[model samples]
Target: MTRVMNAYYSNLIEGHNTRPRDIEAALAGRLDEVEDRPLAEEAAAHVRVQAWIDETSSRGDLPEPTSVAFICDLHRRFYDAMPEELRFTEHDGQRKEIIPGAFRAAGEEVSVGRHLPPSASRIPAFIDHFALRYRGLTSGPTGRILSIPAAHHRLNYIHPFLDGNGRVSRLMSHAMCQAAGIGGHGLWSISRGLARGLRDPAEYKEHMDAADQPRRGDRDGRGNLSLSTLTSFTGWFLTVMLDQIRFTEAMFDLNALQERYTRLIADLYPGKQRLPQLVAHVLRHGEMARGDARFVTGASERSARSDLGELISGGFLKSATPKGALRVAFPLDYRERLFPNLFTDAAPIVPAPPPPPPL
Candidate 1:
């Protein structure tokens, strides 16, 4: 139960004070956090981690600026469909805002202010290996939660998937943990860990600095990173991930939000066939509480309540009890998959860059 994964690569991490056992302990801790409240906000964090993991593990190379934009997209998508007001224009040259993802391609070598050389296109082939790598850590006969951090470091090293590399890389780590059962029926949200990592790359940059160094080559080695910095990055990253599992365990359960709504409307129309639809319409409109259910379903109040009530039973909509309000409730699994920062407000995640090129 305490198998440490990819331990030889410990040197790959920069400021590692944590042991393989420490990672194991963190995984167990994540489980305990959710046992008492299986479907609370905390569970949302676990789901969030898995979403990020899938995004990261699935892509390839990209330019630096593109990578940044890609990450912005992932964040936008992670939330519930996104409120129009939250959309920003400066994204991906798009006139509108959208979910962020990694670029997996090179960007303009220089901004308007600078005239850098034309950037090179990175290899996409690394994706196949990285994807296989995380799977090994997740499914092999001797798998462990440590793979979460390991995969993350490897993902960045590969630099697969352009724009959202950093965001997606962290997501991959969280996803690996969930698949590996590190969350114990819930999630350890490496994104939160990443939030911390982004807050301060110092400790993380210390880990795996050696491995991240630019490969010895002919050209383009001009501003490549050094081994020590890679090590620091690993330490800081793993430390942040360790902290994230604990933090995510304390958040609300995504299912609980929908269930409460379901229970409220179910009590109003126990035997209606169309309750589900009626409920869906009511919840969708948010402010349409006073409107007749017929507007939503072209049926009577009895018909509307019946359909909506059925939806309540089926978990499509929830009505306010004692207060008489209505709200939309997505499928539990759907909600978990889509809205990660459910309880938190939108805020930009800024990662600290590693110490400058080892002086």
Candidate 2:
């Protein structure tokens, strides 16, 4: 669920507003059902990249998040999965191909708004320095946690990729937080906070732009960039992260979850007194023997089977086989009701249409 939200908000921040419904469809191999195929493809690619990061991290085989090689891999994995039409960027009326895992060529010069990135030829050296400096800053967990925002900003400053630099930097920051032991196990997402901008989305971009300013005088840090401005950006970034953490924490609290879960069961299965307990059991235990539903609900086998079938058809429960263990399921159509405020789209959620026949 957080992965879907992350993909939605991250793509939204990049000006591609792929909704959670579309992302969910894409993940379920129903791409043909999604209305905006390109955007759905991008959202799907983002989720896949994050999944790779999580799996690699779990296996302890992840490359250093700050390393250029790891950064390029993030960009490569994301764009490589993108549709052909989305893999190119246009500048000054000219179109250029974005090499998935490669930095901009020597002659490819570019500017972002008012800030001119270093010439493409110099990106390699800048990236090397970036990795080294950050390695030193992140030698300890304390340093690692504190350096997240700075590293995020500095990576964007380097602008290593022809495009997709923003996405790559956000992914790197997420990995950094995970390595630092502050990732909340994917329970919370920084991209949501960054995209929300605490109120206006421009606030995020404004801070990034401010941090790009040159040294503001002797009082600023010794670097060519302004330390005071970077410090300000860091403070804002940390505040946003803390806010997201608190929001997710509150949403998942035991009492809060129980209340919401109860409400959802009641609303979805109104007047069905037995479903709440049965569903709650599956929710708590992860899965339950299908035959045991009769015992859990205090109903006869026939009635219990009927009740379970209803929940399964409603997308509230799932099973791999006719007699398989029943597991809790939160279908996209019911996500907003089950987890309010998780999505900002308030327009009535038309239940997702059925998928088209396979080609």
Candidate 3:
């Protein structure tokens, strides 16, 4: 048996270079300025705070800070392909804005395993729920850590953005952790867990099932998400996040790497089957011949060709015709340098630095 598993997500946050790794690297490189990135840990932490603010909304007279305007602004500034200065401004005085229904792309989806289409009509309330659940405010707006999984369910239910809701939702979950002062900067990235969800739909379903229901028949038993469900969802959320932290701490964990690549690829191609693998094959040598993709995936040449064409259409793979040769190029995110040991052409892989040496 050719026991190959999906490795698409390995590069989203950090891990070995595989097909998905190349794609994510490619996406980030294109979206982010390559020359001078802020410090790694610092950038990651800043992203979590911005993400949390994006997911929350003023509710229960709690001075909710999660708003679509906030989200849009944060996204525009933090994740935009252009410079941060051009993307966002002094948010302190920006007018509150709604996440336009035009947030998702024409065929975008909330989950690769499911679809919760975006609707402007239903978004406001959904945004409210996101900030309130498990939120305990001390001085500022609603604040609390309700576990990443709980927030993920509500995020899907609302389906705020036209295109990047899932990306925002996942980021929002990490933000929840950051707000609790537990990490100040989120300690984990759920992009890895999403990859696990892709590999085991059953496990994913079981986990989501616990936290996807309504709480204690509130006001005529209408809502589906319950407090109990939230707690259950939160528990698993922490566990999975911790798993990712530990796996990375250990220097190398193939399972975690596989999880990252699968999730990253899925995020790119939501409903497309075997798309992540297709992405991986293309990056075997940092590029692929469209005609040879079939050999790598055992699919017909037509199918292989279609895969490349689709990736090109999806912005994951770029096409360039070099003198006398046709090549499909893969995106490279230099941040993968964070893990130096995973590639063939670069410097030798070194053991990742020890975890802060215990306090």
Candidate 4:
């Protein structure tokens, strides 16, 4: 669910307005032919790339986050899975094809607002400098975590790819967080933080632009870029990350979540008892064998099968096969009840305050 939300908001930054529910449907293999198919494909591709990053990071197999290979690979994996229409962008009034895993052609000048990305020819050397500077940070968690936003802004300034630079940068930030041991296992997303900050996308852009400025004065660091501005942005980025982590931790409190789960089961099936026990068992064990559902629910085999079928059909539980092990499924429809406020689109329901005494 967090990955799906990440995909939604990250693409939302690019002006692709795919809804959360639509992304959910796409993940379920239900594509809408008219309006959603394209956005759905794009969102699905983002999720896949994120999943790849997480897997690689967990195995300690990911390339240094700032390396040329990692950046190009992120671009390649995403675009290679994207549909043809999403792979091209206008450059110099002409539609240019984006080749997966390839850098922009030499002499290409891409404009991002007032900022002109470095000439494509300089990208490799710039990336080499990036890797050399940041690769050492990986040895320490504090350095690794602190470098995420700096790395994010630097990569965007380099603008190595023909397109999808923002998505790739965000994914690289996520990979860095994981490598730094702060990923929270996909329970929170910085993309949501970036999107929700100040309720304005332009603010995020302005921050990135500020970091792209040349060193302001003697007080600033000796680097070409404004270290002060970059530090400010990194501070904001770290705040966002911490806020997301704290928010998710509050939501995942086991007692509160179990209470909500019980209420949701009762609301979904008015007369069906013993469903909460079954859900609690799966939630505790992460998964349960089909034959064991009867034991957990304290119901006969026929009754257990019926309840399990109902839960699966309602998108609350999922199984590989009809009689296979079942795992809890927190699909988008149930997110509001199960994990409130996890997505920005679904505001948590709070009761209205009582009217104040008459003045």
Candidate 5:
């Protein structure tokens, strides 16, 4: 679910606000039900790329986040999963084909908003310099953490890819945080904060653009870009990250989370008195056996099975094999109630869809 939120917000930052239900359908291979097929595809692509990053990072096979290979691969993997028509981008009134994993070709330079990226010919040199500088940051957690925003802004400032630079840069930042061991194990997302936390997405772009300005006199540091603005952007970026962490932390606090689940379960299954205890058991032990349902609910064996079946059919729980251990499952309709304030379009509490009629 957090992964879906990350993907949704990342795409939202890029101005592709695919509905959460559509993204859920896309993940479930039900794109036929999605109205905005292209947007759903894009959101699914973003999720797939992040899954790849997490899997690769866990295996310790992920390349340096700043390395050109890793960065370009992030671009490649994302676009590779997108629909063909979405791979082409228009520039200067001419349609240009975007090659997966390839940098902008010479003479194919493009402008992003008010900023023009470096000439294609200089991309290799700029990328090499970028990789070298950030890879060798001071060996400590603080240095690693501080490098995140600096690298995020500078990578966008470079704009290596013609069309997907924003997404690529964001992915790179996520990779850097994970590499630094500060990514909260995918429990929270900075993209959510960046896209909506400030109440306006433009503020994020403004900060990035502010840091893009030329050096301000001498006290601003010797670099061509203004170090002060970069520092300001870094501060804002860190604040957003910290805010997300705190928000997620607060939501997940044991007592608070239990209360939320209790409320949600009651609302989802009104008057099913013992359902919450069964859910609590699953929450604590990760899964529960069919035989234990009666023990936990203290219901007659038949009634216990009926309750468990209702929870499963209602999408509150799932099992693999016939009579397998039951694990918790979060259906889309429950999201708003289960994780309030996490989404802007928090729907009013609604009962889970009724079970399919008897065949």
Candidate 6:
């Protein structure tokens, strides 16, 4: 559920409205004829890459978060799965193709909002400095968490890729959290917080743009950018991350989750008293063998099989194989009942508008 939610919000930030139900359908091998198929495919790609990042993090094999290879690999994996038509950016009536995993070519000049990224010829130097500065940080976990926002902004400021910079930067932030052991077992997402913060699109852009300004004065640190604004943005980002962690933790509280499941079972299968027990067993054990359902629910084997079938059909339980163990599954259709306020019906947030030309 968290992975799907992350993909939805990440795409939402890019102005793609691939709803959660549509994402779920795509994952289930049901493509939509009315909606653009490429968009759905892109969302699935985000989920796939995120899963890879999670696995890599778990194995402690993830590359340094700020490494050029890590950033480029993220771009490559995402666009590799996307349609060719969606892989280019146009500016000044000229189209520039985005080559997967390649840095922008020399002579390329890209502008993000009001700030211009350093010249393409200089990207390698900037990235080298970025990696050296960040990869060597000796901060503890709390300090590392606090450093994510500045690191995120700096990567965007560098703008290494020709396209998909935003998604790649966000993915890097997630990987950093995992590397620092702050990802909370993937229970929370910063993209959701960012998407929600951008609910007022202007404010979101304003905050991001604020960090792009050059050093305000001598006391603003010696870097080329404004350390104060960077610090402020970091605070905002961390607050959003902390809030999401708290919200997810509260939502997953054992008592509350049990109550929510009980109500859900009653609504989906009225008067099926043993269904909740089966759900509880799966939740407690992470997964349950098919034959163990009868023991857990105290129902006859035939009745247990019938109840399990209903649960699987309703999208509440998922089994790897037809007759294998069953684990909990949360379909987006029932997300509101099971996980309330997750997907809001609020207006879409637009991306940051281009900054006005300098005076």
lDDT of each: 0.42, 0.85, 0.46, 0.81, 0.82, 0.80
Counting clashing residue pairs in each candidate, in order, gives 77, 0, 29, 0, 0, 0
- CA shift at 111, candidate 5, in angstroms? 1.5
Candidates 5 and 6: which is better by TM-score? 5
Report model 3's TM-score to 2 decimal places.
0.42
Error of 4 at 210 (Å): 1.5
- Candidate 1 stretches with Cα past 4 Å from truth are 1-120, 141-144, 184-187, 197-202, 205-211, 214-236, 247-359
Q: By descending lDDT, how would the candidates be arranged?
A: 2, 5, 4, 6, 3, 1
What is the Å distance of residue 125 in model 5 from its true position?
Answer: 0.2
Q: Model 3: runs farther than 4 Å from truth?
A: 1-21, 24-67, 74-119, 132-143, 181-187, 197-202, 214-224, 252-359
Looking at candidate 3, the ten consecutive residues that score lowest on lDDT are 1-10
Error of 2 at 217 (Å): 1.5
Give the per-residue lDDT of model 3 (tens digit) for 65-99: 24455455544443443223323222225522323
RMSD of 5: 7.9
- Over the stretch 1-359, how does candidate 1's per-residue lDDT look in tens digits? 10122210121122222332333333455434333222222223223434344444444221121133433444445333322433333424644433333333454222211212123254444555555555555555235454555566665665543223444555444444545546433334444334334445343444544445563555423445444444455456555655544444433333443344445445545654345445545544563463466776577766665554555566555666733566666553333222334323333122333332232
Winner by lDDT between candidate 5 and candidate 1: 5
TM-scores of the candidates are 0.37, 0.92, 0.42, 0.90, 0.92, 0.90
Candidate 5 vs. true structure, TM-score: 0.92
Candidate 2 positional error at 314, Å: 1.4
Per-residue lDDT over 1-359 for candidate 2, one digit per residue giving the tens place of the 0 to 100 score: 88888988999888998878888888888987898988998989989998888777777786889998899999999999998889988965789889998998988888988889999999999999999999899999889888999999999998988999999998998888888888877777789889977667788899999999999899999989999888889888887887777777766665565566767888877898888787788888889998899989889999999989888888888988887898888877777766666767444222332222222
Better of 4 and 6 by lDDT: 4
